[model samples]
Target: MRVTRLLPAAAAVLALAGCGAGGGTKAVPPTATGSLESLAAEVKCRPNMQTDADELRQAICANSDGKFILATFATDRGQREWINDAKDYGGYYLVGRKWVAVGDDGVVKALRGTLGGDVEVGTNHSSHSMHGGSAHSG
Candidate 1:
């Protein structure tokens, strides 16, 4: 008789489990365009880098119109590190409702001006075998 009573309670628990009572889904934001002209206007000048100069220039110029849509930004150190590593030295800025990549070569990249995304600002500190120690992503 006791076994039968416990069975019903166990079944109830299992049913509730499927309803996602513990960890619910996160809501995705609606797609919307944000003005980047203000941001572009803020970008006074571009940095000089022989390696990825062209790519960086194009990205800066693209945002010059000051029209980009917001998406997601890095929230934690690990995420920021991953982004910085992926871009080699510089960091990435998500713009135009899409995740776009940008490179900053030491000189000022103007974070407050041209970036249009969630904006998770942080630092990345890691030691590479070949590169030794370097400070990246701010």
Candidate 2:
């Protein structure tokens, strides 16, 4: 029993030691839901954002190719509606907590992979776009 315990303890120590200076993979950044700054960091742009009284927030991240909006809904119903009634001129997404991100195919895919979330491609309305939604231009 003592030997078994020591083996487990030793394994833990080795694991900790491996992480000290020579970890295999770099750590993932701590992601923030409903945070424009955090989203901006991942997307390589300062986010232009909007928020409702309900704290429903949207952050627009763009590039030369296209743009997308990352949103946070005030209520689950609102989230459900946005998702179910979504138009796919760009990417459709629901992320952590009350967050959503929208953009075109490539942009959305890249963000989702990096930030983590649910995403879909295509758009229903031409007017519904991530373009120029930000407070500033890239």
Candidate 3:
């Protein structure tokens, strides 16, 4: 009797889980969406504008935690390409919607508390052989 009642509930749970199995369904939360200055404020830092252009906006920021670079991109593809290229040099990156923060692991981790994002580690080229393509310049 109890088993019969629980079967329908279990089936409904499974159906809901299958709905999200298509992948790429992860949504960037509102907390993760902001410009360089806005994001810096969340982490308690004033961004010293470095490169301000149509494609990218980068700034250096420092608070009680430490100093780091904060950048926001105009497009998603551009951001991904930049990250892929920069990885060759080896660094710590905090990735969010159209924005990325580069700093030491401790600094980046502290920033993550206020500005929710994923921490991506760059490849240390020194350990492996260098490929044909060069690192992204400016």
Candidate 4:
């Protein structure tokens, strides 16, 4: 019958949806990657203020002057795409192989003395490219 045929298709759809599904999204702290300690120790950030899901492993940091977010990516290419895409935003960015520091002028300038990477001051934050995936084999 029609009901029986639809049941299998509905079950298939549910199975697909279950892939990569989590119970719920969880927030990631600045220290999640253990890199937050290093940055805070070096820059004297207060080691507080975190937000959102762990999609980017993001954390907000503060010092005497201001605050910024340190976002960690799963790979170097992930970091690079974000930085490159952010050129359109024009705000300040301190990028490493796996992390990026995003903030206004004061916060970025505060850490500039010790950190190294491409930087710019602007007003917008463009979205990073995550769909351009590549495949490999070993």
Top model number, TM-score:
3
Q: Clashing pairs in model 4?
A: 90-122
Clashing pairs in 1: 36-66, 36-67, 37-66, 69-96
**Which has the higher TM-score value, candidate number 1 or candidate number 3?**
3
Q: List the residue pairs that clash in candidate 3.
A: none
Decoy 3 TM-score against native: 0.68
31-126 in candidate 2: lDDT tens per residue? Answer: 446455666666676666544345355555564334556566677776655655454222334355566665544554456556666554434444
lDDT of 3 by residue, 14-129 (tens): 23322221112234344478778788888888988866778878777777767777878899987887777665556677899899887666666677776778889976554444
| Per-residue accuracy of model 4 over 10-81 as CA lDDT, tens digit each | 223223322221122233223212365676666677655343333345556656545566666666765565
lDDT of 3: 0.67
- Global lDDT scores for all candidate models: 0.30, 0.48, 0.67, 0.50
**What C-alpha lDDT, on a 0 to 100 scale, does residue 93 get in candidate 2?**
49
Q: Which ten residues in a row have the lowest lDDT in candidate 3?
A: 14-23
**Against the true structure, what is each candidate's TM-score?**
0.25, 0.52, 0.68, 0.51
lDDT of 2 at 102: 59
Q: Candidate 2 — worst ten consecutive residues by lDDT sum? A: 1-10
Angstrom error of the Cα, residue 14, model 2: value is 50
- Rate residue 134 of model 3 by lDDT: 50
Query: Which candidate leads the pack in lDDT?
Result: 3
Between candidates 1 and 2, the one scoring higher on TM-score is 2
Model 4 misplacement above 4 A: 1-34, 49-55, 85-90, 121-138
Model 3 regions more than 4 Å off: 1-31, 126-138
